[model samples]
Target: MRRLALAAALALSLSPLTAGAASAQTARATASRGLTPAEVGTWITGLGGRVGPVQTENGLTFFTVTNAGLTWAVFFYGCEAGVCGEVQFSAVVPGAGATLDKVNAWNRDNRYLKAFHTAAETPTATVQYDVVVLSGEGVAQLADPLAVWLQLLPKFAGEMGYVAP
Candidate 1:
């Protein structure tokens, strides 16, 4: 009888913990239907980075995030009403030191990013990664691409012969 009572008490104690974990999981699933700028900003901040004020231009929204002394902009696209379905992580390094050959090589070698040279008078090297965020992905799922971007930003700058300003 005593053992049965102990078992019942243990089950009662663990039930709340299991229920709480399930509730948190459900909340995350419900919140992950789409990516939002606020959620992105919060994630960036959570990574010990700084996010600039939100900016909109030509019907597109973006904001700058600074980490490890490198700054990049996250641009939102494919918006309907105010929700965006995609995001592009872009960073530009000044100077034409990254020749067409170098840009081509980077594009050929890199897997989740593209590099290009701008046509401006003072040529610049730009690297970008585009992600579709409308696939009901949670923050952890989206962090994979962001992690890749963060890991490659400095290497891209060094390989392009330009320093991130």
Candidate 2:
């Protein structure tokens, strides 16, 4: 009976059904870059879009999150211990309205990211959604959160389908 109770407790803790899909959804990710710190910063190392590296936090570098037609992406660059590199093509929560607020909060809550700031508004269309940049640990400890953000954005859009662009 004690074993059964423990199993039940574990299941309950992991249960997303209770919290709803919005709370339960997770990210899909892949890492394919080995860019050095300098390489990650070069003015010429453009991402799949025009997003540019502009700042750093701890060892984590921050870049402009850009949307290229259909895909909203950003470059989360980080380094830890003796290694440094850039994370390529991570998805970003398109801050259409309240979504940007949520994205900013997410970045603020990030444990591995700090030194947060936002550059001057470029206004993608006319309503420029702010892209808050953060700095934190990289390399060994800097992949999952970035992945989660990227993954959450698309998933959120697909599921919510009502973010009022």
Candidate 3:
């Protein structure tokens, strides 16, 4: 019985799941350096997003990425003279079946993201992250959020009864 238990423990420790966990830890440790607006744009483009021209207004840098049939704006906050302190990802929800309840439910269930409805009957979902201008989590921190957003885009479309382009 002890030998069987020992063998089971060894198999579990050598599993691919354990390797994936280790890899995730390593990625987190290495992605401490944050990104600039331009760098963020580059990363989005690299992720197969259709990126629009970048614009700077006031202290924010803004750009749009069209992916999974949704066009979303990526805003870099506190950007002045080309540096940023935070980033926000937002998408305008289609007005057909989008409701305040859906937004509220999303906000209540989600931990790192939020949804809101505007007076103009537009629903928007956003995810924001604060980062140190120079030495914070860089593209690595953004990769998962972007990926998750992409996955949710289809679900949001379905919930709002909007057809994906």
Per TM-score, the best of the predicted structures is 1
Better of 1 and 3 by lDDT: 1
Candidate 3 has its poorest 10 consecutive residues by lDDT at 124-133
Model 2 lDDT tens row, 8-36: 99989877665665443432123323444
After aligning candidate 3 to the native by TM-score, how far in Å is the CA of 138 from where it should be? Answer: 3.6
lDDT of residue 86 for candidate 3: 68
- Give model 2's TM-score versus the native structure: 0.29
Q: For each candidate, what TM-score against the reference?
A: 0.74, 0.29, 0.65
Tens digit per residue, CA lDDT, model 3, 31-143: 54446778889988997899998987775678988886778888887554465666777767666567777767766776655666654546543334333344565667776
On lDDT, the stronger of 1 and 2 is: 1
Model 2: residue 39 alpha-carbon error in angstroms: 3.6
lDDT of 2: 0.40
Segments in model 3 whose C-alpha atoms lie over 4 Å from true places = 1-33, 121-137
